[model samples]
Target: MQVQKTTIPHWSEDDRPREKMMLKGRNSLSDAELIAILIGTGSGMKSAVDLGREVLLLTNGDLYEFGKLRLSQLCEIKGIGKSKAVSILAALELGRRRKEIQTEKRPKIDSSEKAFKELRGYFTDLSHEEFFVMYLNRANELIQVKQLSIGGISGTYVDPKIVFKYGIDVGACGIILAHNHPSGNLKPSESDEKITKRILQFGDLIEMPVLDHLIVTDNGYFSFSDQELL
Candidate 1:
């Protein structure tokens, strides 16, 4: 009988992801290279690069889309079990926070256009629905932007009571409501109008006032207040 030889994985080399990153100066790397730096290693049949490629494909080229996926969804990829999925998500979130910290230097919101432009980078690529409350001072200076809820496109279930809590907590004198249409239309649905009416009604009671309700699509937005609807 002939003896069979087993092949060793190059990814097992001590200086793989880190060494490649240092040698290439980061910008020269592919998506798989950057992701492999975060993911560390792979299993028998798949290399770390292969696992990262699958992740990108599964997410349709948007890394933020991975945040919308369930752990079960990620585990369906051959080499990415729950732990690896968590690790990737955690690293991505950290990157988001770091980027946000750097964004603090950008000009703050003064007009509805400024507000939408500020929010577009975050909401543009979301796979699921999300609602945001952009708190503003009396002069329309940006105070804080809150993530009110993450739910289905039909609704995000904004409560007048909880919305008020965030307003009071942030000491906002006024607020602008904004949510994205994944369908890429700026038209406000019945649910969007309903939620806007309810929030405005509560703002009436609190004296904080609703500045606007902005329905954002990928390409543009409709402003309820600007249109004299709010």
Candidate 2:
């Protein structure tokens, strides 16, 4: 006869993490209990909750630090294999993306600093050049943000037509252009100035103004409009 496997169901329903989450709601669960549900199971002599507590201790009880852990680092915990580590990482990434999207949804861009604060998160971690554009309606409320190109550390080529196409597609009346400087330099290159002027001219013709051009770096940002170049 096969021996019956022991699992979380063997515990009282109140003590079972998944059941507690369903009945009492997710916010009712403790951090370890939530992690235990993600891990799903534990090694011999350790319950999932016990294993989760160990993992929390390893990260000094910080969820942000826990999210930064690599797969190899997580696997050092006895019950956390590649699959569990990947699941945790994927969940954390989704949470981060959702937060970014929510921040972009309805904010009006009234100043260079406000635009930088809203858009910097997208470029802060990048190691190469990336061109992004924020489409805005007449009220200066953001409609959407789009990545136009990815290139080497030196620069990226952005097609003005594609930028305008996205603006037209979204019914945008204005736009803000942004690009990152991997070397942490805030000064715009000659190519940057040239493109800004070209795009500004096009926007004027179409009655859709280029509100600003921002050079983002990990340290800070430079705005063309603030410098009186726009």
Candidate 3:
């Protein structure tokens, strides 16, 4: 039998991902550089880096929402074949798994960041307004998350009575309110503030405190509690 040698992977003439990772360290590599390493090569006039940048641009550079992408959606990108798409998705899946392993059994909402993480999934990528309420126990451990209403791109109606009903039904001690701004603006509109006060007032009357109100956008979240608006 003839001897055979193993193959290796690199990115471009300089193999920037590999070289930069080796010289500086893996942490020094940008998201594009890391993605290029997995994709392996260029297509047409685009380099691996260019392809990586395109993918990031599609997601607006947030890796947390990367899991929402489907194989078909990824393949729609120019020059990204099924193989390359799978490669990217597989890597993302692994990252999700690792995070899941490290995640707490019952996610405790001790801070705005945790609250945002708990509810962002529901609102991300929504093209219209949708209201969600997360019921939490006394210790702030999530009891349940629910969608209360859906509205057009403009706004959603959040009935404080209906919200109180959900919390009462779940025997929740506190509640977190969230709604998406499909326009990618995190600022709380006048309507947003008014609703928060209404819900907060009713929540106090019922003894189910409103801990936080989050306005989710494509880029990030605006937290009422964090801003002392709650």
Error of 3 at 227 (Å): 1.1
lDDT of each: 0.76, 0.88, 0.83
- Model 2: per-residue Cα lDDT over 27-110, one tens digit each: 999998988888888777778888889888878998756755677888888878899888777877776676467452589999
lDDT of 3 at 116: 83
Off by over 4 Å in 3: 1-104
Residue-pair clashes per candidate, as listed?
A: 0, 0, 0
Task: For candidate 3, list the clashing residue pairs, or say none.
Answer: none
Q: Which parts of model 1 are misplaced by more than 4 Å?
A: 1-15, 59-70, 99-107, 121-128, 183-185, 201-206
25-138: candidate 1 lDDT, tens digit per residue: 777678876777667777666667778888888878776566566668778888897888888778767765654443454355667788787777667446667888888877
Quote model 3's TM-score: 0.59
Candidate 2: TM-score? Answer: 0.68
- Model 3, span 1-230: residue lDDT tens: 96443122333434577777888888988898898888887687677878888888878988766666888988888989999999998987676555433245678888889988877667654679999998999989988888899999989998999998988898899999999998888999999999999999998898999999989986889999989987
The 10 consecutive residues of candidate 2 with the worst lDDT sum are 96-105
Q: Distance from true position, residue 134, model 3, in Å?
A: 0.9
